[model samples]
Target: MSQPEHDAYAASPRTLEVEDLHVSVGDHLVAVSGVSFQLRRGEAVGLVGESGSGKTLTCRAVLGLLPETGEVDRGSIVLGESDDRVDLIAAGRTVWDRVRGSRIGAVFQDPGSYLNPGITVGRQLVEQLRVRGGLGRTEARERAVGLFTEVGLHDPAGVFQLYPHQLSGGMLQRVLIAIAISCEPELLIADEATTALDVVIQAEILELVARLRRDHELSLLLVTHDLAVVAETCDRILVMYGGEIVESGPTEQVLTDPRHPYTRALLAVATIGDWTRRTLDVIPGQPPSAGEEMPGCRFAPRCRYATQACVSAPVVTTEIGPGRSARCVRLDELDTEPGAVLVQDRIEATA
Candidate 1:
């Protein structure tokens, strides 16, 4: 079948909408707060940030797979279009059972941990297809093999009988991808899915995902700390910091001309695209721990441009351009031009 046009899918309704989400680990400790974004049909959005930025927590909330102590303290996660919109927070286990794996699928960083070592990878996939897909045993097996082949696994039938430990890391990842998309879900969440792979394998896996998205019209939520991965795969980028989004815009615009100081700092450290070999820069200080109760801008302490006003009051997200917004108290005073925030000199001095 011919692949659908990108523009055709762009006009479709949103697949997921998260509004002012707040996730708390316990009575205190709000791990994720005031997070909001929308994923249009067939669109791929990357949520990028350093560790402890709540990227995984935000994705977990969307998937309704938060830890035992984690709970949605406030906010609504609406899934599906207007006609069939469902608030995931209000939806009980029964609703979740019906939604997860069928409408929404997820792939995590470690594929091995999710699969059973005792069972053949193919059998596990077949079981999922039989249970969630409602396929007969024979049909499920056939579908499993087909999915394996579709994901670029060589000798699908032969590989099906092998245990999880029998396959290489790249192959295991492909198996995980096959299982994730076996049900043909509308939304696919890949949380640092390629972090464990080498560069060549990572590129291959990313290409596979992009092709699948194009062919199946699947909306993707990619979570990762790697800016280069996001640059290559995502249409838009959401830069997270201290449990909140600090900057968001088109991928090209955000990469080339970040608005927030935090975003610029990240670019300084990231190795994106082809460039001459040079010492990489690093942001100073540690990111705030989850629910650390930052009264003002969370990034103010590490931001060189932060002023009294930045630390005196909470920062609000301000629109700087079309489809672009940033949360920074000194957005007007700072220079956000490409390569304007030169951290190389500081790095050299420290070195």
Candidate 2:
């Protein structure tokens, strides 16, 4: 059999490299189109977008949890040591089973869902360690307890014995963190893991994650709708829209000087600058339905400066140098809006 065309990207030291990933929800609905990015060990990669912009779905793909109908129609995700990069997209369940939850740990949107209400936290963590590390029961328990203490959970012994319903959201999330890193996994994926918690708790979790990454030398893939979170935590950011990455750069650069309309729109609406503000700039137009076919650019309907040229021209990655890139037809001419504006209509959907 011949090698897939995109395999040339396999040997980089990057812990994770997702290239032109296309995932379809079903026969017709494409959830992610041409998404690509890489994560080096000890670095953080953030994916930011509005609800339904495919941020969460992209992370799900990394964990091999695509909807039953969902198919990774194209792309490659290479993870592992040099010269031995494992292809995440083409790999079957057995391959994913070994790599996921072990080599690539994840913490999802709700820690509540992560814990089984009937099981004690210790059981969950110990079981996870045993499964992933192939440790004996005693060894797994010891490591699980050690992990609890490592995350700064006081009275780790007592907390380990409690069930999911017994601990506060923050505590449970911390336990999930313990499970995620117990194997000393090379990568950690956090998908809006703190969304359900309060701000103070969210900051704690974020800080804990950052600290753990630093202490363990782990790569991080952070997926969230919160740009503020990206600004505070991630080194590099990837902005997605209608499935594809529309812009990417150093987190600071993208936040302060976004070049794409979509990225600008995202920053414009951020309430981050004013906590007392009552309203946010709401972008108009619903995201195209999964796999909904379209003839032109996916973001065209909501873009302010779109023209006939944009209607037919495929959005391509335009380099902004220093690792920054934007997908736009008029990158230089875009009117930078520091704040979000409400766009109300599709007006003309075609050129």
Candidate 3:
């Protein structure tokens, strides 16, 4: 009934809980605001939206890896096993260091940039295993080989001895996965992990991640702009806009029956079928820059259903369905079905 009650019901044995998160750069640039979400143990959550919507920033905040200028002005990142929640915003370096790799791991977009070119893959992975899990060199090497094999890498021994540049993109991604899960973290933050790969490779990587999750029983925070990817890999979705979560709910509920105008627009033009004659639909106008303060709803400028109330009213999340909410005043009046608009050419092609 109340927000607190809904949150209490939703916060069931959370592996990661981010409440009222506010991240800012320098003085006035608020990168993320009033962001809140939870990753249940062994569940996958998708933070989906366009670039600069604070998806990556939210993940970074969870991992205590914010940029030097960035600061958590408000909110708390509560993370741990059941009944062991720790507010990471108040935690010091010692706490962060302990939790960063062993308790929680990350797999960023590009393996090229994240992995070292000079170091052998096995060496880097061994170092992580040794440092994070405190294994002896011999034990760490054995663990590294097992991790490599677990992530679907062939010839684990041979691959481990090679540098990052020597491997293909898919192999490099597998290596990254091995490194991320080497310590068997409880939560894994994957920020656009499949963005750089081709379609076939992307699918393979997605499958690998899904299998790894099953094997490891890790909670996943998948941050990406691709709704399709989210649909395929995540169980829940959080749609962000202009650094705030505009809509959030079950993945199927949000995708097939989006309540927010932004979410609907995203679905309308998703190259669903027969794209040869279909011109992709695009959201009008541009998203506001990070920390760009707005008087009202940030998507008001591009929303076709926007009105004076939308532009003037104080924005807050209203529960639309079970465990689902949207940050809009006119949620009641908006159409429940996705009104994805396509180009005239697409309409004719369909006819």
Candidate 4:
């Protein structure tokens, strides 16, 4: 197979910054706590973690698309460049309307859930064009057809007239991508956009996304659990566990030299081949429940190298390398291969 083509975007001063964000459902259950990250202009940052690790919540908080019951209690989500930076947490509906679909578009995990069954694809795309681009009906219709063609749809007019139900999963995903890039957003958030599709279709969607990012000069936040998927698409990786970022760095650096036990465990299972040729290496214990107060390291319960300090002391963000950080109390004592502890645990279990 040929290598994927890359497209570079023009340099810009804009960036998306999330600082000390805390999101909660109702009053008690905090879904995302003290999570902070930054995406520079035209950068693809992959947010990876198991489900319930607060990946989707962080994306929703940035877009101000959190459910009615969910609220941002602490921290600010700042967008745009230095002089014109706007805090999304304080932005009103009018501001969000102007920002979303225009400056910041999102492609959700499921197209069927977001796309209306009764509406024609053309009508939906035209609505976005009219609202975001302030175009007339004829102009919007023309733009919609162009978008359909751009996203690789065969018959623009035919696909435009069809309802959501009329298209296949891959087709619907392509339509969603078309809609997302309709207004040419500076930042595109794809939350598990290819999870539901088969392997072949997922590759196609990812390739399309790569092309779109280059052509449009868009910064992408790809939320996914598969480390391998992001390895192929993202520049940096942010590993989250128990609603907190446990480690983050350049994609290759983090994937090849993981410092946190949680990150190592996640990478161990995200493999195409298992050397053991037996049971796959799995992380023991479940994630803590939402709003559950963790006194020390959130992953200590399942960590083999965990000790008294890990169970009672605060897990400080240790600087493992330049621009790389890991939240683990025993970072200095950790071995190069963190998963070796898993092997030791199994041997002890069977002994």
> Arrange candidates by lDDT, highest first: which order?
1, 3, 4, 2
Clash counts per candidate, in order, are: 0, 4, 1, 0
TM-score for all predictions?
0.92, 0.91, 0.92, 0.90
Error of 3 at 162 (Å): 0.3
Candidate 2 C-alpha lDDT tens digits along 1-351: 013412432233688888888888766588899888888768898999878889888888888888778778888888876676889767778889898888989998788886789989999999888878899999888888899999878899999899898889899889999999998899999998888999999999999999999899999999999877887899889998888899998776777667888887776677554555577568887767777776667888898878887878676788776577898888888765544332111111211
RMSD to truth, every model: 4.9, 7.2, 3.8, 5.9
What's model 3's lDDT at 40?
85
Instruction: Please give, for residues 90-174, the per-residue lDDT of candidate 1 as tens digits.
Output: 8867887788888898998999999999999999999999999999999999999999999999999999999999999999999
Pairs of residues clashing in candidate 1: none
The whole-model lDDT of each prediction reads 0.88, 0.82, 0.85, 0.84
Error of 3 at 70 (Å): 1.2
Q: Which parts of model 4 have CA positions greater than 4 angstroms off?
A: 1-14, 272-281, 338-351
- TM-score rank, highest first? 1, 3, 2, 4
Once superposed on the true structure, which residue ranges of model 3 sit more than 4 Å away at CA? 1-11, 81-83, 272-278, 336-351
In candidate 3, residue 295 scores what lDDT?
A: 86
